[model samples]
Target: MTDQVATTEAPEDWEPSEVQRERNEWRRRRTLRSAVIAAGSTLLLLGIIGGLVVSSPGWERVQATYFDWDKAVSSFPAVLEGLWLNIRVMALCAVLIVALSLTIAVMRTIRGPVAFPLRLVGTAYVDIFRGLPLLLVIFLLGFGGPALSLQGLPTSALFWGCSALVLSYSAYVAEVFRAGIESVHPSQRLAGRSLGLTYGQTLRHVVLPQAWRRVIPPLMNDLVSLQKDSGLIAVLGVVDAIRAAQIQTAIDFNYTPYVVAGFLFCCLTIPMARLTDRYARKKGYHGAGGHL
Candidate 1:
């Protein structure tokens, strides 16, 4: 009796119940099966369409024109040289577009009576440019700018084409900026105001920084579209990648140069597209509060 010791039962291992484990396994299997089916079905559909096209009578001519690997390889160097001009123009336009759009966005957001004219101008700009076809804008600026022929006016196709891009893209970007600014929590604005910040100071120091972050995905998307649209300058005889490709095609009697140019654009755009998707997904979960 004296040597007897109190005994205690050991706690069981903490683990999910059998039913919960089976449910999780089932869900995992279901997800994997769905993914497999989706991928397989897409591949099958694409293969079937490709087979039908290849089996068609025009396939030979289409391949000769558009898919000649030899011509594509031969055209790469010339297309790349022209692409450098496109890249430079794109870089310049991107800077101008961002600057002008931000200014317009701020003006539009102003509520003071004194700001009425600026707001009206900003609204008109957005409406006009957003509605006007991009190609029409390019054609007007590209051809019309040089036709003026005023002393000291730029006569270069590249200059006017880039100007057209800046004007058109700025309007779209301004709307994106405006939307981002409005999405800023009202509490943030109030907090800035309470901290002795003027409206402009508050917008500059607080609102815009957050707004830009939230809108980065859309902005990047627009930039990518602009990047590709740089090819449109070719129509103005700007000698960009597309123009180079067209010239090469005319010489060789093959459309493969155009394919090369398209491939190059795809290479540039795919990374940007992936990054945009990643940013969108991250923002979906983390959002502006993550910063605070």
Candidate 2:
């Protein structure tokens, strides 16, 4: 009876039935049609908005101020030079922020009375920094830290500004890490402990790997934001892309340099955003928001 049933079953290379083939063709056509319609509607909407803008009275002046080709070409070199600094600062701050935030997250998650003070300090740090505006923190560190003239500390606004970025971003990212850590099932920890693993070993080996994987999408989003906000170091007298643009704008009152800077930022940010979306999709997340 088993042999008979096996012989009756369709083989791996068997063709689909007529109905199944028809259904598959219908699905393919439907997908193609939907894609075409979506593209057409998008283009139509953009064309309408663009026509309105171009027909406006001040269109010429707006174009000259914000989109002057010559000005953009001329300012490109300086802004590109300045952008290198933003990249370096952002890279350094990102590394520091991840290290510090992970430590704080671990501290917050530790149990027992012996760890209470560490947890309390971690909580206070997150609360205070999260509540304070990032720009304000940058201002305080950039100006106020230098004013103190502490012997061992550097007075460069760039130093303090980057420090402020690390501090402020770590608070937000620590919460992200903590959320990921908490999402791990208690059974996993118990299993690790039952295998003769210590608490620290359980967390480091069994827990952190999973938590880090789950939190990557949100972490990337935060880093994308960090990349853009790196431009704010310009406020501290750092000659970053935005500052270079500002200097060019001052020379001739043309805003094209500012537009160039903005375009460069978008170029960096959009790819990161798309990669986050791709990763989220790969992890079975299907929504506008992706979180652990």
Candidate 3:
């Protein structure tokens, strides 16, 4: 007994208790039940409405408007051309918006007396753009361009449309950039400073890369919104998708072409929405591990 050595016990790994496990299972079941109920209710409502619509005389009118194959096919090429214009406007605007947004975001993030004025200007820009309707903005830009001495700068309807879009969307995108910058932790900033990097260097080389990754989903969503908003350029008589549809409608004296246009818009938006959702899921998964 005198020669016996003391034995130390190792710490056991922590595990969930039975009660905790039951609680988690219950929560999971509750979430599943709610989702199922929502899906069932939606399907039931859709079924009821579909049955009623199919049985009604007005169903024929709806079908004629939405499913007139001849009219839709006849207008298809013009609609496709308009669709191309929409794509061009969106792409150009996206480039300009990204550049402007980055500059504004960086200015706003700079701390000190210099930062306040820049931030104020950025805020004003965002407020003005976001407050106005998209249609109004397009009209102003399109019609006012000559007055503003900007008409001859580009001259084309596509140029005017892109100009308006970039002006409006840049403001919104700036906020996204700002939010991404703000999301980077102060500790990380401090760590960068401790590593002898200057503020700008740290932001440029370290923080912004992470922030860009975090902000991708929202940026994608904004791009999708911008795509839809491009249609507003039609108010400028730019012969965009909506305008093409209107022209077809007038020529054929049928509402079917308008329905076709609506379908085209859905075609444009749906893919972008799906892409955004995928990006959001990927972002969430990456974020779950805690700080960047």
Candidate 4:
């Protein structure tokens, strides 16, 4: 039969190995060719898009308003100075939020009738702050605090804004800590107890160390967000970077100062994001089979 003749004429079994090697080599070459073609096409498309945009009538106006070199140069000093306030507030809030959130998480995790009311308070605190819009909290804290006019209570806009930032972030971060703590098996807690460790001692030495390692990535992410929200303090009439930008824009009748401020914020934000990614990779990242 024709089928038998075709099978007999095919390459010998010994030759098939050589054929497979050749086929694999051909596939590699094809993949490389495809990648190069894709890269070239993408570059070409980008060039066309760029050319069209550059030739538009509105491009000149946009460049003058948002990219004026002279305006950017003038705006840098005030914006940089104003950004320092944000840095200070964010730093203080970071420390306070971490300490407070850990306390809240611990309270929530304690299992006893005596601790029930404390646990309920912790749960309510997390839910209220996390559910509310961040801007609303900032508004209430910033405006409402000053209106209270309590003698000896800090009336500074900076103080109230920092308080709001601390309050809201502590709630979110408490959940992160609790999740990390709960991810540790119950046997670990029991083992500590069996070894004559008190609950407090076990949490201090065993549970927290591991939980902190597990949650570092999420904590870093939260910190990054917190750092960025430092700008929101501007709503309280604190002269942060965004506020400085607004003043400059009003004075010059150009939007270039806003761009400069945004650029500075991006400069800081990008570094934090990179550091978070680096640490997450170093720690094996919780989402990717690293324990929560």
lDDT of each: 0.90, 0.95, 0.83, 0.91
**Residue 110 accuracy (lDDT) in model 2:** 96
Order the numbered candidates by lDDT, best leading: 2, 4, 1, 3
Candidate 2: minimum summed lDDT over ten consecutive residues — where?
Answer: 283-292
Ranking by TM-score: 2, 1, 4, 3
Model 2's alpha-carbon lDDT is 0.95
Task: Pick the TM-score winner.
Answer: 2
Candidate no. 3 TM-score: 0.79
Per-residue C-alpha lDDT of model 1 across residues 1-292, encoded as one tens digit per residue: 4334323433466589899999999999999999999999999999999999999999999999899988988999999999999889889999999999999999999888999999999999999999999999999999999999989878999889999999999999999999999999999999999999999899999999999998898898898899899899999998889999999999968999999999999988878777777777787834422231
TM-score of structure candidate 2? 0.92
Candidate 1 weakest lDDT stretch, 10 residues: 2-11
lDDT accuracy of residue 71 in candidate 3: 91
Model 2, which residues run further than 4 Å from truth? Answer: 1-13, 289-292
The per-residue C-alpha lDDT of model 4 at residue 218 equals 85
lDDT of 2 by residue, 258-283 (tens): 99999998999988998888888888
Per-residue lDDT of 250 in model 3:
89
> What's the C-alpha lDDT at position 90 in model 2?
93
Question: Per-residue lDDT for 83-185 in model 4, tens only?
Answer: 8887888889999999999999999999989999999999999999999988899999899999999898999999999999999999999999999999998
